[model samples]
Target: MKKTALITGANKGIGFEIGRQLGRKGWRVLLGIRNTLNGRDAEEKLQSLGIDAVFVKVDVADPDSIINAAEILAADGTRIDVLINNAAILEDRGTTINTPRGLLEKTLMTNTSGPFNVILAFLPLLGNGSRIINISSGLGVTADMKDYAAAYSISKAALNAVTKQFAAALAGREISVNAVCPGWVKTSMGGAGATRSVEKGAETPVWLATEADSSLTGKFFRDKKEIPF
Candidate 1:
């Protein structure tokens, strides 16, 4: 049986690249997107490259959407070998002080609560040896730096905490749950001046998805190197 992976926000950006890489490796990749049209476009693109890709609607910010996504996947009746929680929004690209409260709440809802919503919704589809990869960022590190992007940074930090808690809870089941910090990459969100390419950014998450030993869980990784929590 081919291994299966479901990646959220995979219509484009790092999620798309990660899907392509994993699909090339022969995993049945499920590309989750909030918009069905965009998801179909991504599905078509991957299909043209001979990758086994499918699209499912998943808006991580909405609990109903997350539940529906899992229900759609449940029809397959197959276990998910990997789940990449890659959907996030950076509402305030700059100037944290000037950002509104509503923006911060929405950002937290999407960035922090979104992935956790997906995981909890799809927990039944995972089993022993399954991998859960949370796409986080280096900016989330409160101990290191905090100049701007307060909402995104704080939400990601909370995400890392969620990752740790899940890892501990699922350890006995042989499921590995960890967070991957993809460096600044050139995407719509990352912008043109970004130094890293999408391929480079997707490397760590893809690596964690396929290569890391099952024993390593609840850790932070950037390009395969474990980083301090």
Candidate 2:
């Protein structure tokens, strides 16, 4: 049977790269885009490469949109073999003390709440042997060297916590829940000066999706190496 995969915020950036890679590997990829125009563009781009790609509008910050998408998938009785929660946003890259409440809220809503929302909404769609790959960041590592991105860091840290929660809840069901730090890639979000390319940045997520060991669950990876939880 052809494997089904859903990639959130996949219209572009690391999400787009993940879609391309997974589709090329013969998975049926659902690109979860927020806008119809961007969704169509991404679908066309993937189709040009002869991928079995479809676009579904999913605004992570909007619970209604997430619910609707879940309803459609549930109606179709679709079993998502892989779910890549790659949708994220960077708001106000500023110091910890100087970050405004508005920026923190927006960042948490998107980077933190968004993935958790998708997980809850799509829980029924995930099946035994399924994989949940959360695209996280090194900045979220509270044990690592601290950064000034108060909002982004805290949001991802929360994501890390959520990853563990899902892993525990899904463990008996034989589903694997994992998180990966894509590193600073040269995407629009990562900026032109970022060290890594999209391809390089997507390596860990792709690996966790397709090649991770069965023993590895509820873990964090950076560049294919497991990091401290």
Candidate 1 clashing pairs?
none
Local accuracy of candidate 2 as per-residue lDDT tens digits, 78-149:
889999999998876778889986988999999989999999999899988899999999889988737588
Candidate 2 weakest ten by summed lDDT: 141-150
Q: After superposition, how far is residue 81 of candidate 2 from its true place, in Å?
A: 0.3
**Which ranges of candidate 2 are over 4 A from the true structure?**
145-147
Give every collision pair in model 2.
Answer: none
Cα RMSD for candidates in order: 0.9, 1.0
- TM, every model: 0.98, 0.97
Query: CA lDDT, every prediction?
Result: 0.92, 0.91
